[model samples]
Target: MAAIAALSQNERTLRYVIDLPISSTEYNIWKPLFKLFLSVKDDESTICGRILQSLTRRESDNSQISSYWSSMLENGLLSTLIQIFSLSKNDDALTSAFLIFLNLLNEVPQIKNDLDTIKNCFSSMLKHTRSTNNQILTLLGRVLSCLSTDKLLIDSMVEQGLIETLMILIDKQRSSQIIYPYFDCLANVIGKSYEYQRKFIYSKNFLLLIVRSYLQDYDLNLSLSVIRFIRQLVKNNEELQNILAHYGVCEHLLGALSASSKELQQVSIEAIQALSHKNQKVQQILLREHALEQLLNLLERTNMSTLQVAIVCTLWTLCENNPLQKRDVATKIGVRKLISFYTIKSDEHLLVVTDAINELAKCAASINMNIQEEINHAQGIPYLIRLLKSDNEMLVLSVLKNLQLITCAPGFIANRKNQEIIVKNDGIKLLVALMMHAKCDIIQVESAQSLACIALSNNQCSTLIESTLDFSYSHLVDLMHSNDVNVQLKASNALATFVYNNSRVQLFLKNHYQFSFDYFQKFLQNNNESIRCITAFQVVVFCGLINEQKQSVNTAVGCGILMDILRTSQIDDAKSAAAECVARLAHMKSGVPQAIIAVNVIDYLCNLFSSSNDTTIGNASVALGFLSHIPEGRRKLLNRSQTSSIRYFKVLSNNIERSRAAPLSDYEKEQSSTNIMNFYLPNIRQKV
Candidate 1:
């Protein structure tokens, strides 16, 4: 003790004493030694600087300094430092004291980790943020941001009026001096706990006050810090986001987005994105304020992945399900340039870019040609196709949606390049994989519909051959009866394409298929009218082309199902489908006899013939003309004399003759006019 006291008298000796590195030591000696130069009443002017310097020096060494800090904190050394910060007037003294606290809270976390120490520590730091000393306030901001990691200290700091103090600093000060530290303090507190967040959000319009400071045209650094604080505050809190947006604070954020500085632009883009998330009203507000133009401007100026991510994400929020806004963004940032980002960004940013593109595709009716040509020109289809092989369900689902959009666009089919992309990328095989076996029902439904579009675009049946070469016919058939109505419709439509003029496919089904037309006939009665319509369409196509297999269809489809579709369904397409299926079957042996006894399709056809729908009248007339040759069918048709439309069936026969007479031989033409019944009835008589 005598020796240490002798050294403490000299400045150099005292400096050496303060600068000594600490190891695990006796707390009793360390506290008294530290107290000589540390505290509000720090012993010497030079001693406080030396002490902070020693702490700073120790911070640079990647060694354990916590034991030294832990010993001081245990022995009230922290209390002494806080007392010095509370009273010190010298910038050197205050600055050194602030650094000591930052290290203890930030570097030597053992002190902050102790609940009892941090509790008092938080109170002291909150007290210091209100300091008139700018140096103290700045250091306190960083300290609070650090200390806020303790979930336990969250309510303690809020109760100490921390939020109110920070709010007052930013609102009242026009100077940029305390801006970062001021909002940094609030961001720390609000980020720690939801209770604290609500307290700030609901109190004094705390968030709006921070946003107002952002508009002060202060230093770019200060505006960025304020924006960061705003982002941290409302990031996941939908309710608080609503409050800020309601107060028109989101407009200021948009203003910041249009600022000249890139940093402020980046942070503001992030802030707007934070507010726009999951809050539909705020998205509308952002769109109304022309935030999309601001975002495109930023995207053009910046190449940083982080900034690009922010801009892309903001576009995503602004454009989802709102096609007009999507077209607005897509036009400003050309579709070609937008899709060109696919290969440049990392995985995370790529996700944001692709999502923006995906949303834009929703307005395909308006933006189809521009986007389709660019996608084909960019060869982007194969890249999107490969994403379906990913393990991430959301990524794969997003890719499926974009592909679906591309396949169904009107310009997509006419271009042929886009359709070739789907085929060239083996999109059908991937879609079929997701359709039959994906775990999520949504993925299954989307995949099926995508495949159905590809089938519909079969230019010469080449797409069908490419898709169904390794395809599971059984899986496709099974999807026709799936519990999901979308899956059923898509499956039935694909089946129509699969057999359209592809007699090899029909023969293959006949040779290897297990389900009868009965499986298809049952879906005709499904409550969904579209499903019934599509099912009837497939039944007609199948019965029309497979003349050699006509008897099996007649037995499986039967007359009753056809009549039910023709009678019960109000859909014109569905009734037309039933009439066409009935017409196709009328040529087979006993086909008319079955209709007369089982389902009474002739009476339904007669009723169809009297309709105002041109499609219905033509279909009904054709089916009746075929039936008029059969003994029982003619008897049934002759019996329904109640309506003049049915009695005027001969007029329909005259129209069919006139339309077909143009290409017929002279003998056939004369014969067609002689007997309208002879026009269609010969097939029945010849087959019988």
Candidate 2:
């Protein structure tokens, strides 16, 4: 301690303390000793002239000295040093205080709670921001950067017209390089106040000041820092959406996209991307200016992880809103070239690849169509198929969804051999794997939908039914029991289509898929209305579409289930679906009409006459009209108890008798009698 204090007094031995361990308590004892060595604090020696000699000693030793200085900054000593720091007039002493302060603030909990005290001290420092020594201003800038997030300190700085002062220091050609720290602090403070962007934007001239400073200075770090603030300012302020319409900031930022510093180029790219959000005019300008080419050039040269992330994000934005731009860009830089970048081994790069692929997949469906010929020439399917097995679940799901979109379009999967290639390459296996094992229900549902689409292709349709009917039927039943409503809805829809297209599928349903009907009924009881509606609708579709030729007996039971749906809950739509399903089944040769009449179809149809929804009433009326086509249904309608207060039947009979028609189409006569039956019938609430 004595040795460093003596050196500080002479300016010769001070260099030695730079090598001493600053983190150790023993070495930190010298911090108190500096109070006596700082004679220049009272003298008029050129601040830099007095400080340069000692700074030289520590120039190559910032780490060791920073550590030792930080160890001395616990609690009481920090306050005493702040007091001494306030009294120093020499720029050298001010610069040294900040250097030591930076180290002290780096200790998290120490300054976290002391922000108020620190802000008060900083207020005193800014009073001399115009100190003739540029070094002092620069040191103060560094101190401000460390404390920029502190609200009180920022307000204090803002009160002093510090923005103009920092703008002066940002002029690197004439300003000292030390001013970069000040620029950093200024940028960070601006970034924190996004919610107040309007207040800040309208109240201050920060944009003009930064743009002018950037034009003159052109420092990569400073320009990048300012660009980040611009990003934040625009992000939190919707009013700034039209910035490019007025200010030339967009042009300067585009120019910066070509900067030599990869970091600066990325910041510029990110700023441009942020500006382009929902601003088609800004995107058009960038596109017209060929800014994308500039970004791509940077992507090709830089392999830095952050740069790649920014580049991917930029490309993703351009691609999502404007597919023509992506297709055009893909024409110049082949899709494979862009996708192959993900093959880079770094985990960071892989994370970026995952994000990029997810974004790209949103546009992938569009791209696959526009570039199908070109992709076929390049064999793009193989690349897409490879991503299906990627360890990343999200990436796999995204790729699967895009591939499905490609296959879903008309005539895209026409070739039987090309369709088989997916199965042969285990693509179907992967879809099945996702259906069974993927952790996310959304992914599983998407995969299941994709499989159904693939099975729809004429080339693969019948064969897919024959080979996988048993397992797929069972799987669909199990997925119907899934807690995920989307999964159950999709799985049920797929199963309906399967049973409709293949009569043989009905045997499996009878033998192996019986559990599905019970679960389907449970789904109808789900609290989510969409789930209940769709589940009931799907069960109706399956029963209505079933093939009586292959499994007549089970089809009879399916018909009874449809009738039970109506009787259990005359929820207008469920009743309508039940009625529609009955109409379809009655036309079948399976004696489903006998089953329907036995379930009291006449009473169920009359209950729907009071339904307020026109469609529900119309559907129930239409189904009753179909049942009236049968002789036995007419007998059941007239067999009701004479004493029954059938309000609806009375209305129908009066309407029919008033019309004076001895003869009526079975449809009209049945509708008339059902309406009359409804008037005499008491309102009945059926419980599922």
TM-score of each: 0.65, 0.58
> Candidate 2 deviates by what RMSD?
16.5
**TM-score of predicted model 2?**
0.58
lDDT of each: 0.62, 0.55
- Runs of candidate 2 with Cα error greater than 4 angstroms are 1-34, 37-41, 44-67, 74-77, 103-121, 147-179, 190-193, 196-199, 293-309, 345-397, 405-409, 412-433, 436-440, 453-688
The global Cα lDDT (0 to 1) of model 2 is 0.55
Candidate number achieving the greatest TM-score relative to the actual structure:
1
lDDT tens readout by residue for model 2, 415-522: 243345566666776777776667777676667766765664343554653465233556666776777766777777666645533445555575654433555666
lDDT tens per residue, model 1, 369-438:
3455566777778888877888778888788777766654421122355666787767777777787788
TM-score of 1: 0.65
For model 1, which pairs clash?
40-84
Looking at model 1, report the run of 10 residues with the lowest lDDT sum. 659-668
